[model samples]
Target: MVQQWDIVKIIGAIALPQMGGWVNGYLTRQEIKGWYQNLNFPSFRPPNWIFAPVWTSLYAGMGYASYLVWRDGGGFSGIAQGPLFLYGTQLALNWAWTPIFFKRHELKWSFVELAALTATVAATGFAFFNINKLAGYVFIPYFAWCSFATLLNYKIYKLNPESTATIEEVKEPKKKTN
Candidate 1:
């Protein structure tokens, strides 16, 4: 029923977003150089190396799930579309958090954003389960990762309350001192 080209297109669409998200995560790592060493992370926090492999697998699963949903068609109207949209939105939010937290160094803002991201992903997973069981299953790891990330964000925020100040405000003091 489905052509090979259609499958390719679906894979492309899904892969592009996932790739962007992957890149975003990597950029976040670069932006947060020395972050782990500097911060008082929780004992349960996984090592920095673990994030790469886990995220790589999660992104691959996301791409596959998107392909399955694409094969079904109907976009948002399709059974999987609801989850797809939710997934997409959360991914976009996920990408934004890196820039906010790492580049901007707004830990509190990042905390709020991560919370929203966690909630949206959970909702997406729930929606996906109602439509495609496999697709829903694929998102479980992503959801778990987000949950862990949320806790990390919360701890970071609490540990560094003043870290939330805007760049302009935080930088002004340094400029004056110099």
Candidate 2:
């Protein structure tokens, strides 16, 4: 007998962060061609379209693993609290990266955020593994992806140091008083 805390809930937990991320990604995608996608990439860059499915699958894995922890690890009271907190922390960091990199066009700062997100995910994985080996192991792929992303983010930053958006420069000067 599956309870309320089943696959659907797990998927929902996983999807929540992704939902915010996708909105940011989609809203900024139209401007990406001249801004981000065409920037010089490392030789190891994967084709662009691959990111969608890869992220989708990874999100699913994240959801399932978190569910296992929530269900099997005593529902955030005893052993589950630590891992869940770490998971939520990393998830927020994960949610922030897209908007920073894509919408704000802050490559160097985005790399910084990616570095934090990668580290947070690693910490979450350790906490989760301590609670449930499967839960912790599930994050391994996400950690790996984030690790790769750190390098990719750095490469993009190096490749286009001049392309950062200048919000301050875009602001209009105050009009002279009458």
Candidate 3:
């Protein structure tokens, strides 16, 4: 039997991760269509159309997993603190990846970030599992996807070495003071 507050928590939990992704997507939209389109992706890279649906599903799953962890581990109480912290950390890393990769075009740095994100995600999953088995289990697909994405990022970094070069900033002419 689910209570009213439970429903609210469930909705809130699920929406949180999705919201992070939305913000990142919104910020990186221009780069996705422009800079990202020019990248040399691996043969295994899926079509652009696949990313939205796949990521949406993955975010939803991760949200639900967090909800389970929250519910089963005793909300924000001491017991849930560690797992939730890991969740928040991974979520932040997840949000940071797109802008780093797409907008800034920092291929190598983005790959490094993604690798860290993957490890943090794996740790979070394990922590969630300790709280609730289902919560841990729900992270499987996310972990798998992250692993795949890490490989893809690595390949992109390798294939596009020129992308990693530091851009020389052209200084504006010194303004003449009145």
C-alpha TM-score for every candidate? 0.83, 0.87, 0.91
The count of residue-pair clashes in candidate 2 stands at 0
Report the CA-based lDDT of candidate 3 relative to the real structure.
Answer: 0.89
User: Sort by lDDT, best first: what order?
Assistant: 3, 2, 1
Let me know the TM-score candidate 1 reaches against the reference structure.
0.83
- For candidate 2, give the lDDT of residue 112: 97
Q: What is the lDDT of residue 178 in candidate 1?
A: 38
- Give candidate 2's error at residue 111 in angstroms: 0.4
**Residue 135 in model 1: shift from native, Å?**
0.2
How much does candidate 3 score in TM-score?
Answer: 0.91
The TM-score ranking, best first, is 3, 2, 1
User: Which sections of candidate 1 miss by over 4 Å?
Assistant: 1-3, 34-36, 76-80, 174-178
Candidate 3 per-residue lDDT, tens place, 1-178, comes to 9999889988898899999888887877767777778888899999877988889998988998999888888888868899999999999999999978876778899999999999999999999999999889988899999999999999999999977654332123446799
Candidate 3 wrongly placed segments (more than 4 Å)? 166-178
Residue-wise C-alpha lDDT for candidate 2, range 49-168, written one tens digit per residue: 888787888777787777778877798796788888888888888888887887777888999999999999999899888878988898899999999999998998898876565555
Mark the regions of model 2 whose C-alpha exceeds 4 Å error after superposition.
1-5, 170-178
State how far residue 97 of model 2 sits from its true place (Å). 0.4
